[model samples]
Target chain A: MIEIRNLTKRFGSLTAVDDVSFDVGRGEVLGFLGPNGAGKSTTMKMVTGFLAPDGGTIRIGGLDVASDPVEVKRWIGYLPEGAPLYGEMTVRAFLRFIAEIRGLRGAEARRRIDSAIEQVSLGTVLEMPIDTLSKGFKRRVGLAQAILHDPHILILDEPTDGLDPNQKHEVRTLIRGMSAEKVIVLSTHILEEVDAVCTRATIIANGRIVSDGTPEELLRRSRMHNALRLGLVVGDAGSAGVVETLKAVPGVALVEVDAQSGNALEVMLFPAGGVPLAGPAGEAARANGWEVTELHVERGRLDDVFRAITVGEGGASHG
Target chain B: MANVWIIYKRELSAYFGTPIAYVFLAIFVFLSGIFAFYIGNFFEREQADLQAFFQFHPWLYLFLIPALSMRLWAEERRAGTIELLFTLPVTMTEVVLGKFLAAWKFTAIALSLTFPFWITVNYLGDPDNGVILAGYLGSLLMAGAFLAIGSCISALTRNQVIAFVVSGVVCLGFVLSGFPLVLDFVGAVAPPIVVDTVRSFSFLTHFQAISKGVLDAGDVIYFVSLIVFWLFVNAVVIEWRKAG
Candidate 1:
């Protein structure tokens, strides 16, 4: 388990991470979602004991990061942003070095290194120099190094940033498999990636966490209005009255009459509470002498929720 | 200590894994040979001491030692591998000491290869082999001192080029502090006590005392303390940057 309390970092006059606090339980995959310049990487660095927090505490497995940094580091396996690696060393050599530093020795170290290589599917490039590999393969090499010691917490920054589609699938599967024993925290801006891999997400903006919850819960909390659009075939001069009558329904919020083509009119309905209005709107249209030809309910997508919670509407505050 | 040794093995192997070790060794051997044969007049006067060889080491190290130590931490920071190293279970002391030892040992390897020159001196004349051995020890100690300074300077910057330049200037100041040119210049402007204090801190002054076939306890203590002091500074710098 990891507990971060009021973690803050300041670089000169710039407050990069501002009094952010959260907890990550064991076996939970938490996605850190943010745009460019967010404090995701800085927060990871502090938790991994690479950077000291200016004004808070981070404990990994009950070891304080600042006071017991060595012990905390022993519990963390971090893959830094961009996967910084020693290009001069071969993949095997680099893994062995990391293993030695993590206190693995003899047969145990070798076994762990071999398994990590297999896990990252880097067995083929084990003997090759890391500088000679492509970007995707180099990332795999870095992943192998991070998992070589098999710590309880894994902090990966952009694990799938440079991977191809098939590679991304394999890495996602690997992460999901590892989530049974590891507290995995990964960062990405990809919405679908969070939906596919993360059980929970913390969205950060302007150096503060704006929202935190499961994917479905975030969608429910954003609570933007849902809409339905319908094309109708009605008698002449009756389409205006049909739109006005549909607007009077209990769940319907607004009704707009669209352009007419011959005898057909397009009518759009907005629901106040994001309810499924297609069926009710169709019924209301049918009762008003309008033959409903097309009706579709549009639910707010995760992208819409993200934008609403992060940017919000004009003059809207997100806290 | 075990963690220090682990880092030591990896860093030492890295030196050998590239052409750096070979190049440094070749240059050191060629320079030592030239100093022994031409400057010392090994065959003409048949000197019984290694003064000529040891005399030029401080000047030689003023350039070469910085080159060897410049990349020790600067490259790690530039390549972002310092994050990997800092996050490991090893402490800052271990990392600094391990890297210092690795660079010192590389210098030791180059010093050891000049043993063939020692053999030639022994073959040509009734040289004081004990004094020659002491000179080699003094050279190694002085190299460690230079390397410690270089390592500390290297930790201050991420650009290897800047590390090289800064470490070079710092090492040069130490090497030139005791020379007549610098001491006379300082004497003309400063008080006697100030000049004496600076002269006492010069690495070349202590190295020269040991290189003259006399192992002064004060010089030995000075070199050892110099190594420890600079390594402590290295640890502090790394810790400070980590906090930043």
Candidate 2:
């Protein structure tokens, strides 16, 4: 478990991380969402004991970070932003070096190193220097080192930032597979990653967390929740009865007429009390024998919610 | 201490993993030979005591030790590997000490390559071999003192060229402190006691004693304590400014 309270950091006059606090339990994957300069990397550095918090207390596995930093670091594995590695050493040597730093030696160290290499698919590049690897392979090597000692807590900053699409999927799968045992905290601006791998997400902006919840709950923050857009191609038919038919559907509180697209009638259906209009709207279209051509239900969009919360809409930032 | 050992192994191997170790050793060995024989007139002086060889070490180290120590912390800072190192389960002291010891050992290796000089001196004339050994020891200690100052200065900057120039300038002060040129300047205005104090602070005064085979405990303590003091400052500087 990771516990942080009132975590704050300042770089001269700029308050990078302002009074942030959160708790992470075992078997939880917390995705940190933020825009550029949102303090995600700073928070990770503090939790990993790289940077001391100006005002705060951090405890990893019940040991206070300030008092017992080495012990706290022992319980945590961190992949810093950019995965700063010694480019001179080969991949295998670097892993062995980290293993030694983590107090593993001999057979146990070799065994763990092999498994980590296999886990990240870095076996092929073990003999190659880290500087020679591609961006994707370098990221995997960083991941390999982070998971080498198998610490209880894993803090990764942008784990899949420079990887290709297939490599990103592989990393997502790797993260998901380990989600049941370790307390994983990863920072990224990718919205789909939150839905794909993160069980819970926290949105940070202007050095403060604006929202925290499951993906669905965050999506519900969008203005288009429970709104449905249905287009009909009744063959030269205008908005003769489509708007009325959609409005008459049960659980649909409002129906608005939209502009025609290529001789197709478009009508928007708004559900009552945040109920789903997909079922009722689809049923109405079939029952009225309307040649429905296109239909889309807007449960809400995560990106829209992210922009609204981060752009300081409604003054969401506390500082 | 085990953590320190791990970092030591990594940093030591890191030197050889690049072309830097060979290059530094080649240049250091080549220049020391030229300065000791050609510049210092060792061949014409016909002195078997190696005073000619030992006299130029402080000057030699003013340039060379800074080169060895410049990359000790500056490279890590430039490449951003300092973050990875700090995040490990080790303190700043361990990291500082480890890198220092690695650079010190590398310099020692380059210093030991001058054994042919010792062998040649022994073969040429009846020499005080014990005094010659003591001179080698003194030269190595002076190198450590120079390296410690260089390493501390290296921690203040990320650019290696800046690190090298600043460390060289700082180490030069220690090298010139005990010379008559500086002491005469001190003696002209200050009391004799102040002049002696300033002379006592010089690395040359203590190194000269050990190089002559006096082996006084005070001289040994000066070099060892200088190294310790500078390493402590190195740690503090890193801790205070690293997060920034």
Candidate 3:
């Protein structure tokens, strides 16, 4: 378990992390969602004991971080933002060095090194210098070092930042596989990543956390949650009439034309409060003799919730 | 201590993993020979001692040791590996001591390569082997002092060129502080005691005494304490940089 309270860090006059606090227990994967410079990396640095916080305290497994930093560090594995490694060392030599300092020795060291190599599929490039590897392999090498000791906590910063889609899937599967026992915390701007891997998502903006909950809870906060998209066989000249008719549905509070083509139209009907509008809207459409081509309720769009919460903050969406 | 040893092995191997170790060793041995034989006229002097070879070490180390120690921490910062290192389960003192000791040992290897000079003098004449041994010790201690200064400066910036140039200038200041040209200028503005205090801090004053076969406790203490002081500062500088 990792617990942080009232953490703060300041660079000159700018507050990089401002009284931030959160906790993660065993078997929980917390995804830090934010824009660039939203203090996610800063918070991770403080938790890993790389940077000291100006105020507040961090406790890992019941030991204070500032007082017993090395002990705390022994229980955690960290992959820094860029996954920096010694470029001159061969992959095998580099892993050996890390294993040695992590207090593994003899057969135990060899065993851990072999396991890490196998886990990351690094057997082929063991003799190659890290500087000569591609970006994907370099990242895997970084991951291999972090897991060599099998620490109880894993703090990975943007673990799949530059990976290809297949590699991303592999890494996500790896994280999910490891999430059953370790307290995993990873930060990313990718919304789909949170849904795929994280058990909980925390949205942060401007050095402050805006929301923290499960992916489903945050998705339900979207305005489009439970809203229905109705595709009607109405002519282009009747889009205005279609909107007026759907606006009179019992649970729908708003109706707008989403798309228009000759003799076909797509419109959205937003529910009032938390009610589901599909049943009432469907009955109204049948009574009006309208031909309904397509209709489905949205589970909610995370991107919309993410944008709504972090829009005015700096660099909200580069997409 | 175990942690220090682990770091030390990695750092020492890091030197050999590149062509740096071989290149540095070759240049160091070659340069010492050129300086001692051609410039110091070792053959022309026909001396029974290695005074000519021992004298140029301080000057040679002024440039060479800076080149050696410039990458100690600067390269780690530039490559962003310092974060990886600091986040590991090791203390600051262990890392600093480990890196310094590795560089010092590499210098020791280069110094030991010059044993042929000792062999040549022994084969040619009845040179006092005790004085030559003392010279080697003095040279090693002086090199340690220079390395400590360079290592501390290396921790101050990410640019190795800046670390090299600044360390060279600082070590030059230490070597020249005892000369009359500098003391005379100091004497013009300060009291005699102040000039004497300034003169006592020069690398020349301490190293010259030991090079002449006088293993004074004060000189040995000076070099050891200088190394200790600078390494402590190196740790402090790293912490400050991390915070900044």
The global C-alpha lDDT for each of the candidates, from Candidate 1 onward, is 0.86, 0.88, 0.92
Give lDDT tens digits, candidate 3, residues A1-319: 8999999989888888888898999999999999898899999999999999999999999999999989999999999988999999999999999999999999999999999999888999999999999988999999999999999999999999888898889889989999999999999989999999999999888788889999999989998899999988854447778788888888889998888878788888999997888888888878877778999999889999999888855545334
Using DockQ as the measure, name the better of candidate 2 and candidate 3: 2
lDDT of 3 at A261: 79
Please report the interface RMSD of model 1 to 1 decimal: 1.6
TM-score of chain A of 3: 0.93
Question: Per-candidate RMSD vs. true structure?
Answer: 3.5, 2.2, 2.4
Residue B46 in model 3: lDDT: 95
Sort candidate 3 into its docking category: high
Expressed as tens digits, the lDDT of each residue in B1-244 for candidate 1 is: 8999989988998888788789989998998788767887766765766777788899889889999999999988888988988888889889998989989999999999988878777777788888888899999999999999999999988888999999999999998899889999999999999899889989889998899878999999999999999999998898888533
Model 2 alpha-carbon drift over 4 Å, by segment: A229-231, A239-260, A265-270, A287-289, A313-319
- Every model's TM-score on chain B: 0.96, 0.97, 0.97
Cα deviation in Å at residue A87, candidate 1?
1.3
- Give the per-residue lDDT digits (tens) of candidate 2, residues B61-106: 9898998899898888888889989988898878888888888889
Measured with C-alpha atoms, the lDDT of residue B69 in candidate 1 is 95
Q: Kindly give the stretch of ten consecutive residues in candidate 3 chain B with the minimal lDDT sum.
A: B235-244
Name the regions of candidate 3 deviating beyond 4 angstroms.
A235-237, A279-293, A312-319
Candidate 3 chain A, poorest ten consecutive residues by summed lDDT: A310-319
Q: Rank the candidates by TM-score, best first.
A: 3, 2, 1
